[model samples]
Target chain A: MVDVSQASGAEGPAISMRSRLSPYALPIFLIALIAVSGIVSPAFLSTSNISNMLLQVAPLGIVVIGQAFVIILRGLDLSVSSVMATAAVIATGFSGQNSDVLSILLIAVGIGIATGLVNGWLVTKRSVSPFLATLATMIVLQGFRFAYTQGAPSGNVPPLFRLIGSATWHGVPYNMMLLVVLAIVFGVVLAKSRFGREVYITGGSPTTARLLGINADRVTIIGYVISGALAAIAGLVLSGYVGIVDNWVGRGFELDSIVAAVMGGISLSGGQGGILGGLFGAAILVVVFNAVLLFGLPVQLQIIIKGMVIVLAAAFYVRRRI
Target chain B: MTALAPIRLSSRLRANQGVLVVAALLVILLIFGAFISDRFRTTSNILNIFEQSTGLALVSLGQTLAILTGGIDLSVGSMISLLSTLTSGLIAGKVSMVLPVAIGILLLGLLIGICNGLLIIWLRVHPLIVTLGMSAVLQGIVLLYSLGPAGSVPPSFNFLAYGKVLGLPIGAVFILVLFLLVALFLRYARLGRYIYAVGDDEVGARLMGLPRARVMLTVYGFSGFCCGLTAIYLTSRFSVGQPYTGLNYTLASITPVVVGGTLLSGGKGGVFGTLLGVYLVSLINNVLNFMDVSTHYQLIAQGLIVIAAVSIYVEKKKRV
Candidate 1:
């Protein structure tokens, strides 16, 4: 409604314009990193290298899109990484080397819906904090994965998955194409739809949203379900790319998604930013990771650097807001 | 007068509800354990539970402090990992080096905690993000320090875990002493009450002239100190310096605090409650072991218990 827009207008056009420019920082930084990478390694900008980087970023970007939606509702999906892992295990374990891709996909989606519903129920119906509820879901799901696998998950990802995960069409990775389509669809929905507007209103203030007749609980639950489903899709794609599944399949993704979302200008407090910003953030992260690999640094050093970058990015954004 | 009496009784129950719930859960678990296994009632088994609970108890003490101030420290697990790796690498079976190594590890913990506190307060970053980032950094540092499981602690260091003092394991005795000291401090100290006040309502506490930033710093720093202590125990118990030794410790530590009936939202929990929580979890694990149930079931149970416990507390608060 115009009420929300009118309320935001009181902040003045200058502030709004500044916020508009703020989202570009991540993409600019990504470009600078890419330039630096090319200088460090002449082959870094090669088509093969670039395509590989895109492939790496695709799954994360998809997951961050989902994370963005949840953050917009002032909630965090800490269970995302675990959900991804579960999906990967389920997809492979269910297919059982026979490559029953359709059933595997169905089961993965079903798991996502079920986990999301549980999270939503705990948070909404039971009145548990989102952080704790998602955290509990993460732990339980992780345990379920271990129990199902009994410490070792067996089975290979089907060829159909491999095609979507790793295959390219005319020099463009299928994964990247999928990401672009998803990004556009989500971006349009978030930017133009009434549901998206309701999400923003809820994130800004649940009480205010409820007073305006928005079903804040329903919006919040839907946001979580979308996040869970996307995370599962990303996991499925990752499984296909790796062609194997393991306990540590999606390790660090939860943190990485948060970092990327935040870096992309998605406010941690919620009700700000967009899908494009999250995509840029994911791209920047993948680029930095690619650069680190090219520099011949140890994996430990890469993690240390990534951690420092997250802290620094957060600090920078906080300072800018002030 | 009759209505007043009922109201008073309900109010009294509400005031002590967290403690009562935890106590009831502990009793139920004990009864369940005794009914299920002969080993559960044995003196040695009970002592073993206490011994196993010592590390978690210490970590939960720190977590209780942090949560009391309405913040969290996800880096505690990583802090334990770093401390243990450093201590074992430095001590390397040298009894003479224990004091200095221990001091060094604790100091690092203090430094890490201070950094977290300062960043959260000065930079105005959320404690969750800062601590999560710090956890990653600490993990990376641990991995860098030791690529694999390396370093052996001295036989004397093992005494911390294996030693018996006055018919009790030394670790359990230490835990009890620390718990009592913290309980007394929370009951009597100015800063302790300030932590509760701040967590309950930060702005109100600020307006009341409480040193808000200082309280936050001290809680986080103390939490780090606890992690250092936990690291010492873990290293002693495991006898190895592994990079990933305390991978689940952060969540494990938090679970007991919440299960002990501390509101994750903060301001209403104590070290004693956390101790009860630690024991409850340790007892559950012990019972599961005795019952020959898979460890995964324990994980599922723990997750469910935290959700259930927090839900009950929320429901009760709503009623009140």
Candidate 2:
């Protein structure tokens, strides 16, 4: 519907430039940001600092993998942050010695999957928009958390959680290693699997996908399920890193995951970007957040910067697509 | 062709079903509320419900316009938070500054909306992202400006919310007048119809040579203005501005719009239905408060209503 004022002859360079730089843009930008930060605060890139950053980023990266799948399927999951928080709270609530780690893990993932199922069912079967469905779920979950916690949450992040989340091997945090392994596995799942291609097709063109016998609804639901499961895992990782359970835990990671996925080249409108890009986006965010903390800036700056990142990334990725 | 009249009648019933449902539910709630609680059916209590609903009603009107045009404004809550803070901070309890501060904050709200619209157009990004980002920016600004209850309004300024006109709260009166005006505009005005047309079918509206950019700008700008108005009322009610004052309005505003029968997909909803939705939600909350029974199951009742309402409409659309 837009009027193209320029002639075809004049529009060639911009198109070529986008193709050449878009994929590598986040990494290049990450490096540039690192170099600036390293110069400004030489301690920012120190070995210990890097490991700390990795530990902090693992939770976000884990969630980003899930978020990328949902975005790739042309859906948004607002309930992810809620899921993350709920999982953490429930995991920590079992303060008794009788509770095993495996049971807690199962319960956390079960919460995520159940939420994903509800979200998926709403979007796919009941015909609710993904945004609204997830938003409603988020609200319900928030209310649930409030009712359960009554504004004051009790319980500690288990020692096992803290150990898995913060412990390192040869200066590499365990959570970071988990994130890397999960990313590779899911990345391969997304790029090479039949389900992965189906997700892309459904997002890119539901009609075409339907014609090709892809169960679009089933695929979309699975995407939500994956998002839910990963977000739950992310929640535990976050609680471990923080070493506590509180109402505020995992509150804003939904936006961060969206920003990360979108920044990493996962298209907001769907059917684009990849797992590696999401990881890179998470890297960029962690570095930015680390730098902000390093500067002793107010946390409010992080909120403002996050908004700017979403807008800028949307501009970079979405503007050219049309 | 021969059966057109009956089909048209049925379709019209179906079309207006959301408002009818919400209206019926509102009536049912009033009845249930009155039956259960001694204080429920009094005129003052009922009027109080309407007064309390003014913020939601005002904000939802703007949300209705946005959703009606196949978009959303997630920044309304944050804008309210920012504007309310700016209002009290700028006025600083000076009665003389209230006029200027009010005008400035209202304009700022409109400016925020226009910025959201412009960014959407410029970046060719979805409204969700633009407004979500704007929401964060506004939230951050408000936090930086004030972490807690920041400033106070003069006693005289409280009239916006607390003043009574013919036994009705002034704020509710404003809602009546504004809702009626917006409803009329939607029914008769060109831009109003264009809003529906745009939301109903963007491609068709573009092909019809409608000013798509201008339409989006006006829709968002009005939404922002409504938020500004709501913030003012909120500030008047509370007598002080706090950073978190408007945070809940973002979701609260959307609920009324959808519950009143507006489609999230845009194009088929109205201000009156949204108004009814607002009243219904307020009454539900009031009744819940009266009962004092917390439904862990009940906690989700609101979200469930939104989901259920949206599902009904969306399912109907799919079948058609």
Candidate 3:
């Protein structure tokens, strides 16, 4: 890592060097994981295997995008798992034949927005704590999923839906393409947009943001809305990829998203992290996840590893945690 | 300063703010229950409420202390489940082994709590993340230990949960006594007061020369201990220890704590309001069951109640 202190100082030689690797430092770890996975099982490096991993990463990566935003605001959304499940169920249950895909996607996104709005409203207007508020939504949503699914959730994903999950064009996975597009768009929005700057300001220091006339509540609400909408998209993608409607689908993504965000160097203390960094985090986590699967580790042990990662990553990266 | 101290001190109690609200809710629930069914009005059924709520009451006590210190122990649910499986698996229906095993489980819980405290302090991470991570690790351990209910306790041990003292459930009565003692300790004790001080302002509390590390460690330890007690009680009640025993507890425990008027930001809540909160939750469940509501809807109802109660509490706190 380039020493920021020296690099930013009058060291003429260092001043010209842009440490691109230092920024997305996670890539080195990602490369090492790929190398190890390939060595452990030669088939792991196969294009098919790599694409399969990307398919898994896509939904989780999108969810991480949303989770990263919330983390940037020093808030949490335990409701994402429920939100994701609800979205997936709504899409397949309501779609019936998968005609008019826009409507189903819209409805799913609508649920996400409404859920996010309620969460934000409760936190800002009603003064409920972020985690508890979302947790309530999570509970209510779980019941809703139970009630809605009945025995089996309605309908199946359309063949066209596989375009995003499985179909590839020019040797690139479609889901990866969509994810790349999302990363660029949202990444730019977070890094360059006025709203993004406001997010950082409000999150980093509410008092200072207030002095600067930023509406912290508005930023918080919008952040949640984006998170909710993105979570819905991720859920829809997951459900579509699975091609079935099950209540347990996307069950633990809330925690996964947090882990990804933390791994991506998104500080829980707020006002840091970017979309690209989060994607890297998502990629790293998914690679590790695939490694666990390839090694045939039990689900129980996978859970232990995940928990350990969240703790270790947060301890390493989250400044001002105390 | 002396003249205002008691008033200010009383105001600082978390349970005071929502004591009346939860009490009022309980009264309304009781009346509603009475009107709803003859089954609900019976003394046996009334006692049943306390008995069923004992598990939550025990778990929430530890949660209360954790929240009081401006941190939360998400591990308690997993701890409860893990300890339950261990307590039952180790005892294995042997009377001679029960005492030793139960004590060992409680000590293990304490050890986990201390580990949580050490991790938070050493790593300089919030307890939420540390405990959350620990919860996952413990949950995996539970799953690895048993896919289902693993073992049983002797019939004689069942009395811990089922036995009554003067018509009240043993678990409920004992838990009530425990709550009262903790309330008194929080009110009259120095260490107890330090909990509130740390929650209200950690830096200020440290500047006051309080032992913040000891306070954090002990609070988490108490939370773990409470989970241990709950596990034993659950094993006694169910006769078998299950992996999913405390599945809903992590979230369920917080409902009573926050609705009891404890701020999520920590500080300013007491166990008394939590006692009322427990009763209120029990009453709500009882009323719902009497109404023949689906168990699925019961989750929604509980969650809705949490949201409503929290909103009202937040409004009340802000006004103050």
Which candidate gets the maximum lDDT versus the true structure? 2
For candidate 2, give the lDDT. Answer: 0.86
Query: Model 3: how far is A175 from its true place, Å?
Result: 1.6
Q: If both were scored by TM-score, which would come out higher, candidate 1 or candidate 2?
A: 1
Which 10 consecutive residues of model 2 chain B have the lowest summed lDDT?
B311-320
lDDT digits (tens) for residues A230-302 of candidate 2: 9999998888888778876899998999999988888876777788998899999999989998878998999
C-alpha lDDT values of all predictions? 0.84, 0.86, 0.83
Q: Model 1, residue A284: what's the lDDT?
A: 88
Clashing pairs in 3: B14-B268, B14-B269, B14-B270, B15-B270
The number of the candidate with the highest TM-score is 1
As a whole number from 0 to 100, the lDDT of residue B314 in candidate 3 is 71
> Which candidate achieves the best DockQ against the true structure?
3
Clashing pairs in 1: none
Task: Give lDDT tens digits, candidate 1, residues A181-227.
Answer: 99999888888899989988888777788898998888888888989
Q: Give the alpha carbon lDDT tens digit for every residue of B151-207 in model 1.
A: 788787889988999999999999999999998998899988998998887778888
Instruction: Report how far residue B282 has shifted in candidate 3, in Å.
Output: 0.8
Give the TM-score comparing model 1 with the true structure, all chains together: 0.96
Return the TM-score for candidate 2, rounded to 2 decimals: 0.95
